[model samples]
Target: MDVLLVEDDKWLGQAIEIGLTERDFQITWVRSGAAAIGELQRQEYQLLILDLGLPDIDGQRVLQSVRRKQLALPVMILTARDETDQVVQALDSGADDYVTKPFDLNELAARLRALYRRRGGHASAEIQVGSLRLNVNSHEVWVADDPVRLSRREFDLLQLLVSQQRRVFSREQLERQLHHDETPLESNALEVHIHNLRKKLKHKDWIETIRGIGYRFSCD
Candidate 1:
């Protein structure tokens, strides 16, 4: 999963980033609401951890602008403001959840999971694809009834492909899902990952390569 953390406090920002990253989530951290808005426009994040007090633009305004754009991603407020009116206003203005400052990192993670679940988004735990099962929490992959060892990037790539099996994903789209740098990736990186996965999977044809297009995961 991808999350955008807009927190000004460096210590708390890094702490949240590291904690979520350990759970196989890719997080992009920004300091102010302006930066948060810019990043959200350019990228597709599954969730946002936004702080209400921002140095440049108020986080509330950022939240307002975000709701205006009408993206499907969920935003969770993480600010020191615990006032009842502010909390109600935030929820009214599209905040998915609220977390006061000094909140537990575990609590934040749980809320994010809950938001995703409520939105019918992906779970924080495992998901099944045919005979294969992917344990997202543990970053483990299994094919049929046996365990399958995969490199971190391979697993991430496969998870993206398998999760949306019917869709045709371009290399660029796959890169976004993998949360790599915005720069274009090497032409062969996707092919290389596919090759590695096929070798480990021992099913070279399970993933179909669309000529002159991209790749798709199809059982046939």
Candidate 2:
């Protein structure tokens, strides 16, 4: 999923971005509040990670503006402030969750997943398509009651397609979702992932390729 990371600490931001990317998150990191607001206006993201101690404007003001504009995406506050009143204020201002600094990455990832699932109206961690079941939290896939191991990218590709069945995704769209902005993608890199996914799933017609268009998960 696409995530907007609003952080000013270069080292911390890079570490968080790398960690999230490894777990199949597409991130756009911005250092200042102005940049964060601009990105939010120009692009779409599934989640927002905002640091309250921003360089340009206060993070609370940013969150207030997002709510005033009626942006419904989930926002998680990642800041050093751990006071009770601060957490309450953030939640009241439309923040979904708050994680203080010096936190555990794994815990943060899990919280993000929970928020994501809730936003999608899923009460459970599992998403089932046809005979395939995917445990979103665990990153485990099962087909017809048999376990199937998938590489990180392969699983991410399948998850994206399966979650939005019948919606076609173009090559450029998939590439952006699967890769970071700084990473150069090979011409065949996406194809290779698609091929590997189909092979591993052993279902030839599950994912349909539209000539000159894109790919879609077949409901047939």
- Which candidate's lDDT is highest? 2
lDDT of 2 by residue, 1-220 (tens): 8999999999999999999998888889999999988898898788999999999999999999888774678899999999999999999999999999999888889999889877757667788988999998899999888898998778888888988889999988888767855668789989999998888888979989988988988755
Task: For each candidate in the order shown, give its overall lDDT on alpha carbons.
Answer: 0.85, 0.89
Clashes of each: 0, 0
lDDT of 1 by residue, 1-220 (tens): 7889999999988999999898777899999888888898898788888999989999889999998995677889998999999999999989989999888877778888889786655455787877778898798888887899998788888888887887889878876765565656676777888899988887877788888787888664
Candidate 1 residue spans exceeding 4 A from truth: 121-220
- lDDT comparing candidate 1 with the true structure: 0.85
Off by over 4 Å in 2: 124-220
In model 1, the clashing pairs are none
> Using TM-score as the measure, which candidate wins?
2
Task: Assess the local accuracy of residue 217 in candidate 1 as a C-alpha lDDT between 0 and 100.
Answer: 80
Cα deviation at 204, candidate 1, in Å, is 56
